[model samples]
Target: MGSRFVNLLARSCNGGPRHFSLHRMNPANLFHPTRSAVPAVQPLADAPLPPPALSFGWPGKKGELAWMNFMAFGRTGNNFLAVDQIGRTFFYDTDSRSLRTGMPMMCKPIMDPISIAVGDSLYVMSGNPGPSPGKHCFQALIHGRLPASDTNDWSWYSLQPPPPFVNDIPRFHEDEVKSSCGDVPAPYEIGAYTVVGESQIWVSTAGAGTYSYDTVSGAWSKVGNWSLPFRGRAEYIPEHNLWFGFTPNNLQLCTSDLTASSEVRPPVLQNMWTDVVRPKNWTLRDASLVPLGSGKVCIARFFVTHSDNFEDMSAYKKRENFAVLEGVEVLKAGWAHLRMVKHKSERYVFGRDLVIPL
Candidate 1:
């Protein structure tokens, strides 16, 4: 129920600094900056807050990284991509959290887009119309070379009549592709989407079940281990690999072949750890996975978590400030950089990723 985020936005249109009208659960922690180390400090004895991490660049456009509706990617802190409430998406380099500019023409009206970093390309797929569920749009990870050959020429085109929708698409491939093949994968499988080992697509469903899409054969198959439970499973791509969230209940991470695999696993955090919060019904909140320098990645996991029982609805406000999870890669492990989207007052704060006191 704590879905609505960003009481205030970045580059706000106010006279002073941006002000917000939302409450968040940011644990109290003080920033102790040393030589490459952030020693943590506690405000009181009750809550032991973690330390802070290196401040990477913002994961937004115009050097802006404050968008309520955004998304990010992965473990090593290498890639982080974000999509604002509007349809615009941003790709940032993790090291500096800096925006990378090389591939041009990234404007499109994609609703719910699935991202995958295959080989050298960032494939973005699916999206119907409006914010509501509808049709699907397809775009290539790698841009085709245009004859014009200008940096500005780099962009994606709309591939309509895309993978068939779960409802309207055929049940079997023999009837569709005419290959005498078995069941083929439909392009659209509702909101179910996944990325696996470099390149793969896995779609999870309640009725149709889990299945993988074979890009080459142009077919689909029921996923292995049908026994695996599916609660609030969601998928996204920032860069490098595919990300799948099995049961939003704790949201243990699992990876597999691009075509979907039977075995699934949980992801190790930047600091390689998990807290006491119970993850449930994960909606693709604000995400932006960017790679910092020195093999480090920073992912701002902006999703929501709730009690196993619907008890503590206090945090569930119709409006809330920007709650972000900033992941920073450490020496042997990784550290999370948690802080509130600072207000001009610097009095109120939002909480999440915090570097541990060492």
Candidate 2:
């Protein structure tokens, strides 16, 4: 067993009085299904609420955990897949609250790779390969699958790279390129990706364009000249028949009808919500939306707390890191209006570990 998993088990066993109702309980408490040692003679009506399920850390030193890319996998969405810059893979099962090492990636090491989960399989796309003089461009596409029962049988296989035109988009003027010796333009990186329905994986580039990859035919096709309105991974909400994701610049929670987008037009954002009121000094580092079935979603935001000191900004004692987890329920208010009810919010002091939903 991984050390991280052991630590989680220990913490769970030592937890104080907790409610039996799963709805009000912390999701992390569900990790370990072990019953309490001493049964309560009578329910403590005023028992303190348990800590958020976001306390555990990843398997790495401080700062190293930020380099890894994470995605929720498996049929129950209880397993999380994490891959680092050096091709190392880790599988974490929330049901068992255990971490297991998986096979290394077949492609070269990618920094902040784009990943998406479709059914039981996971697909990874382009990223910065390395920092060498000529190897600084974004490239590579591959995927891996979970074994039916044997964990050791898990592995990855290479897939065809995106079309060459994706990299031909000019980043600088011809005259400027001709004047400079080492000012080569880097290839376009993935801006966002989501699985459409069941067989199609839609990808949007930074400014190049949008494209679709057919998982069944193993073929790629151009979607349109415009890019997806949101960034990173978007989750499909079956109840609303729309995809929910964060807007590119402001990190606002937004939803769009991807089915309406086509080669003739771009995706349209139907609704947006300012779910969190953040401070000016706090820098938003990352955000993810995890759908918890039945029109409910969890939003996780990681922030870097900046110091008031302007001079000597690099001082070690000037900064702190933390994360906020908020729950929201989306409902239909009328024929055309959608209502979002914000629930309780939990804050935790962030560290090297990445708080991705299992």
Candidate 3:
């Protein structure tokens, strides 16, 4: 058994409370399922070069804040959109290596939102109305476009959230759950899923299930059950035909065919949340998937640990840890043909994939 699964079992066995949070840590990291349409031209033996290390500039600026609740990165051509916790949006022209200020999202006091870039346009799903406590804006999907020719002019556009999705939210709403249980209920959790060549963005609502938004047709439809449940994020390996979800507990996989099939086709592969990655003695902080231009992916998991002896709780440190996993068909269980590349670093910022023009 993988150490992560064993560790979780050990904690439960020892009567340590297992709590699930939608946030990163409590479930701190939020991930959007995305695909890079770039094809793998070479085999594993002649793996293409890894992407350049991301340059965020200063330590405490917009993109570098350690404590930001939610942040997402997306790029189209040479333009990179870095949206941080404070609703501030900055555009980076990768070609020029220059940063420019962009319009801020109108929705203030936003909860967890999903940001994605399609072509030269950026889409943000802000699920609530602004500045109101507990006011769920279940029907709003915000959009922004990076200038193609007009560099000086760009703003955010708002679109109605898929009607069926908005209407259905009231059914499994948190307020009803709390009232029935005679206590506060866990917050509603939302996660986004998408692919590079596909226009649909699949979103999962906690008490509810999975739903997909068609960017091309501008419609939403109720999908099936979520394949894997995690607090952090998910990544799609285009070459492997797999989607991987990262959480504090374990790493899981959702096959591409499984995601598209309305009914579970292959019994073994149906709802197959395969455990692929696991690390011992570390609390999973956040993770991002980077495609290494091969049929494999580099999974960077941020882990934090305190002194084992419990001498002082404040003596905690974060580490940058990563591993590369090659895609393979393992019929039974557990990840096969996985390789761990040792990396040691103290930097613990959120990691993400950025495709730049070569």
TM-score of each prediction: 0.43, 0.70, 0.54
lDDT string for model 1 (1-358, tens) is: 1111111123223233432221212212222233245324212122222222222233345645444222333333134454543444455544463665443444454544555544445555652221223333555534456656753333554444344335433355434432112223332233345444444556554334455655544455555423223223333333323332333343333322233334453232221123224234433343333333332333334444433445656644322223343323323222232221111111222333211100
**lDDT tens per residue, model 2, 82-172:** 6665677777666776777645564555555566666667666654221221332323223433556533355665556544335535555
Backbone clash count, each prediction separately: 50, 0, 8
Misplaced by over 4 Å in model 1 are 1-91, 94-108, 127-136, 147-153, 159-161, 165-192, 214-246, 249-358
Q: What is the full ranking by lDDT, best candidate first? A: 2, 3, 1
Better of 1 and 2 by lDDT: 2
Q: Which stretches of candidate 3 lie over 4 Å from their true place?
A: 1-79, 83-86, 102-111, 126-153, 162-166, 169-187, 225-233, 247-249, 252-256, 263-280, 308-358
Q: Evaluate all candidate structures by whole-model CA lDDT and list the values in order.
A: 0.36, 0.58, 0.38
Q: Please tell me which predicted candidate would have the highest TM-score against the true structure.
A: 2
Candidate number that wins on lDDT, 1 or 3: 3
TM-score: model 3 vs. ground truth:
0.54
Name model 2 segments beyond 4 Å from true: 1-69, 84-86, 102-105, 128-152, 161-168, 171-187, 312-316, 351-358
Candidate No. with top lDDT: 2
lDDT of 3 by residue, 1-358 (tens): 0001000000011123321111111010111122332233312221222323233322244344321122333432224454444556665554465667645553542434555545445565643212222332332223433557544456655555423443444443444544222433322345434543567666655444566667787777777644334433455555445554444245444333435456233212333334333346555544455443344333444444434656553453232222222322223234433332222111222212211111
